[model samples]
Target: MNRLFDIFRNKYFLSTAAFAVWMLFFDKNDMLSQYEYRTEVHKLQQEKDFYEIETAKVKKDLNELNTNLNTAEKFAREKYFMKKDNEDVFVIIREDAKD
Candidate 1:
């Protein structure tokens, strides 16, 4: 008990404990702020990873469209509903289909 009380009474120990408490709870960038920052970084990293995958898919599509005339035409017809001047475009929609 005496040793514990002496340890607590030491000025250096008290100052160090006070500093740790301040840094953990009262400083400009505290524990909560650090956690929030880390969470935000994680979320941004996920978003970046998702976008990179999407970008790769888009780039692959673009390359295919550039290299193959048939693929380009298919993409245009499917995405834009494009047709030749004399061709008829028929769109079939199922009643049970969902958007």
Candidate 2:
């Protein structure tokens, strides 16, 4: 009984147990790293969702352009500042009132 208790309470055993606890809970590759990795994964998922929505919108616009000449011309004029020949275009710039 005394030998068993001595083995259980020995300095080497205690130090090894403490080291294991430290490595499992406080080391560089532990719970904190897992939490950080989860956060990064969530951020990437959100970005992917946002890009998917934007891609859907672009695809819808592209499909519309294929079948709609008026929409295509409007998109080209608004986005690319295109104008017909012999047509005059005026641009109005708004200025902030507060200095």
Candidate 3:
């Protein structure tokens, strides 16, 4: 017990402990700020991954539309309301939205 008290009272050990506590709890860039930075980095990484997957899907669809004439025609007709010269197109809209 006396040895432990002596160690605690030593100037070097006391100063080191005080410095560590100050840096961890009271410094400008402390533990809480570090945790927040890590959380933001993880969120941004997830967003990047999601966007990359969406971009790949879009690229695949573009490739299919470019290579397949039937697919291209179907996409154009559905997305842009296009039609052949002799065809009359009628659009039907639903009144209620589905969840």
The TM-score of candidate 1 is 0.80
TM-score of each: 0.80, 0.67, 0.70
Give one clash count per candidate, in the order shown: 0, 0, 0
Q: What residue pairs clash in candidate 3, if any at all?
A: none
Winner on TM-score (2 vs 3): 3
Clashing pairs in 2: none
lDDT of 1 at 73: 97
lDDT of 1 by residue, 1-99 (tens): 999999999999999999999999999999999999999999999999999999999999999999999999999999899999999999987787587
Candidate whose TM-score is highest: 1
Best first by TM-score, ranked: 1, 3, 2
lDDT of 2 at 75: 91
User: Lowest-lDDT window of 10 residues in candidate 2?
Assistant: 87-96
- Angstrom error of the Cα, residue 62, model 3: value is 1.2
Give residue 5's error in model 3 in angstroms: 4.3
Give the residue spans of candidate 3 off by over 4 A.
1-5, 83-99
Write model 2 residue lDDT over 1-99, tens digit each, in one string: 999999989999999999988887999888778889999999999999999999999999999999999999999888778899998767777998996
Poorly placed runs, candidate 1 (over 4 Å): 86-99
